[model samples]
Target: MTRRASATISTQPSVTDAPLRYRLIHDQLKNAIALGKIAPGLVLLEGPVARVFGTSRVPVRKAFEMLHAGGLLHTFEGRGYVVASPDGSAPPPLRAPLSESALGFDEAHAPLALPSNSERIYHAMEAAVSIGITFGHFRIDESEAAEAFGVSRGTVREALSRLRDLGLVEKSAYSHWLCGPLTARAVAHDYELRVLLEPAALRASMPHLSKEKLTLALAEVERAIDEPDSIDADALERIETALHVECLSQAPNKKLLGMIGHAHMPLTVNHAFYNAFNLHPEAGTLVEHRAVLKHLLAGSTEAAVTALADHLHAGQKRTLQRLKVLAVLPEPDLPVFMHRIS
Candidate 1:
């Protein structure tokens, strides 16, 4: 057998102590963007960037390349790169606040529209989760996403970056990305966090949850439960998230509500596990949710809390069991972190 070539090694002195030149450049430019020093849509030329950084073109070029890859910079055939904008213009105008009228259905009977970013991000997230659950953990490159979404690479990148920020996807050391193969421990831990946070949220806002909001939430849940096909796991996941979010929205604590909102990924991933294992039938879930809803409607906070806790624990147990059967998760010990609904 032919011997493998000796591994090549760099001869340069270790620059471990020195500031990473490219990272510095990256931060500086990012700050400029954030501070509006370079306005949106302004072109960033490598030669000019090098001169500004007082360095050779190599590092600046590399930095620009990195930014471009990150979707913060847009590249064209002849014009080099410019700041990427989601809409390619000034940001869209703000919409009116959500109102009772706004919550009403159209003649065609679709649910009222949510914000564009919310809708787009939600759909993209569902697709990402579905792909992850079915295919195992896999990295999605920008080009693949661009084609998949029928949008520009910049839009896809922007979405991916958002997902990354949400902890739904993580970038690998080798530049690959992974969605989920979410360990059971991680799932249990996330649910524990949710349980600790969500019930308290519902209790705090139970008085504020208006009839309109309840109606909207109930409709969403019913729609999800009534879906004809079992394989539409994405729809089921969305409906599930919507139900929990609707409950949390009743809480008047904006900060706490925001935290609950951010908990969606873990919730979605956990539910995906539930779907994979068929832990509970639709009728079973409907019965559980109905019990919780009845307690809430009756203003029985303690009863609602108990019901919600039991429901969440059931889900956690099912997920953990499935993980064990798959041989992909370790057996959890006593006093294991469980999703607490405080």
Candidate 2:
């Protein structure tokens, strides 16, 4: 008979109290391993762990790497990690069901409250609503959304409420949540705000911009442009985010940054357009992004600002064209959670 590892729960600090989210997840998993709660030879996959934690796979991936490094986990013949035996020997892989309870995550003892289900579903819903709005106004079915995401109704409500805060959705007078018919006027309004604000934010952020970050940003653009056919909506969005979001993240003013974030509805618009049409970004966009990144790399703050503003101006036109195409095209089938109101 194999000897079981002694179960020892850490008494130091709550996992949630960790500053970095990945670190928190790592610590929790490590503790679980130490306690033998994670059975030896159990296969731990990223997607399941992310869903269990109500987080994206990125953090779970990082946590898995940390565990593997610590010898608590080992790479097997297939994907994901297999728990190592207490004697550091390989055991038969166990593809058993993993749960919070099995991992010693419970309310009474460690109290490792997973992130709210709302957070887990927010991005998917955001993408749906953002893309749906371009074609026509929509009324979101809260119950259906909850069912679709396999979460509670209250969770969907919280996610929609956050969208409302971001100006992505609105509550009707009759207490219904509405998304949009994203009009050219609304698109222009968002671009106008971005044109005025983002350049200023860029200028403010210039001194704080690191060379390595700029180089990486430049590399991403180059790669996307070099491999246009392979580029997907997510990659395209990352390039846009590198310039508009990540690059401007170092600006000194919090209020200004907050306002800029709210004004970035256009980014979503572009993202929706590309995804809806199954298209890649135009060469022009890649070039414009490259120009601004180059200017920043060369330490030309003013040039970078000018290039960024110009790019936004040009992007507004391209975005308007995308809206026009959506206007002409047949309306796509709405998701179960969405119903056309107009």
Candidate 3:
């Protein structure tokens, strides 16, 4: 039996100026413990709490650490935390099935609003910029993008800021946003960093990778391989994400995860190439994916990590070739914001 969270607290941001996400989670769990909605000896795990909040486990783990520091939660000889007994005495762990309403978000307080305007438009902007860069040097008009997306310039600016963080776009000396002419050197540079960083991230993530999750990821790869004709650029991207982003998402080091994300500029190139050519990922690409996923499912963490690095190594050549092809082809129709500069 597994104990579950049972809480009643507002998800709304507090009056304080601090970031709301982690603070909200902390407050919710603290209130639950104080109210005895969560029993004194019940176990609370990061995974379940994260699922309830529809967020990543990192913040949930942070909240748990905060609770332990505050003496609201204490460590037992187990994986998760135990709620502190009110009388300053240790109690046996309480394990039982939780009620339907237990650990549920209150309907009135549910945080179900759509993401901010910037987030909503970010992927589309990223895709457009990624594809645009393959053609030649270009300038992005902030005002034009605002009009095209029916958003404010400020919103567009924020989205572009994120793009800059990922090294997708940069400001020229004249202060215009420019995306390029992705060079082979840049592709190789990204892979060089990935081969070092991604394998380490995968090793850190192995402890958290559940068998079921790996199985589903492997199944997706196999499906793409079997039905290559049915696999489009979008499907190819999905399989790539299953291994790269989603699989590695559970790593606890925030800075490491951010670095891994920043190093993925090459992913956009691969995606844009497949879409441009109306092609699927190469068979070798799918086979490499299958190999890594299979090793993970077999509990060979080192082998899986090594396989991932090998895949990246192979992918660099493929991506570089695609870039060469795109460089030679006539520029396709671009979005309103983009203007070819060279």
Question: What are the lDDT scores of the predictions, listed in order?
Answer: 0.57, 0.81, 0.78
| Candidate 1 lDDT over residue span 47-131, tens digit each | 6555545566777788888877777777665455767565444332322332222212122223222233333544444444432
Shift of residue 174 alpha carbon in model 1, Å: 7.4
Off by over 4 Å in 2: 1-116
lDDT by residue (1-342, candidate 2, tens digit) is: 011233221211122332555788899889888888778999999988887877779888999999889888999899898988888776889997878876667643333455556776776677777778887889998988877777799989999998886778999998899999889999899889999999999999999988998999899899988888778778888888999998998999989999988877778767766665567779999999999999999999999999999999999999888778667766665678788888
Cα lDDT for residue 319, candidate 1: 56
RMSD of candidate 3 to the truth, in angstroms, is 15.9
Instruction: State which candidate has the highest TM-score.
Output: 2
**Range of the 10 consecutive residues with the lowest summed lDDT in candidate 2:** 6-15
- Global CA lDDT computed for model 1: 0.57
Where model 1 places Cα greater than 4 Å from the true spot, the runs are 1-125, 131-136, 147-150, 172-176, 212-239, 270-280, 321-342
Candidate 3 accuracy as TM-score: 0.65
The TM-score values for the models, in the order shown, are 0.50, 0.68, 0.65
Ranking by TM-score: 2, 3, 1
Every candidate's CA RMSD: 18.2, 14.2, 15.9
Error at 219, model 3, angstroms: 0.9
Task: Look at candidate 2 and give me any clashing residue pairs.
Answer: none
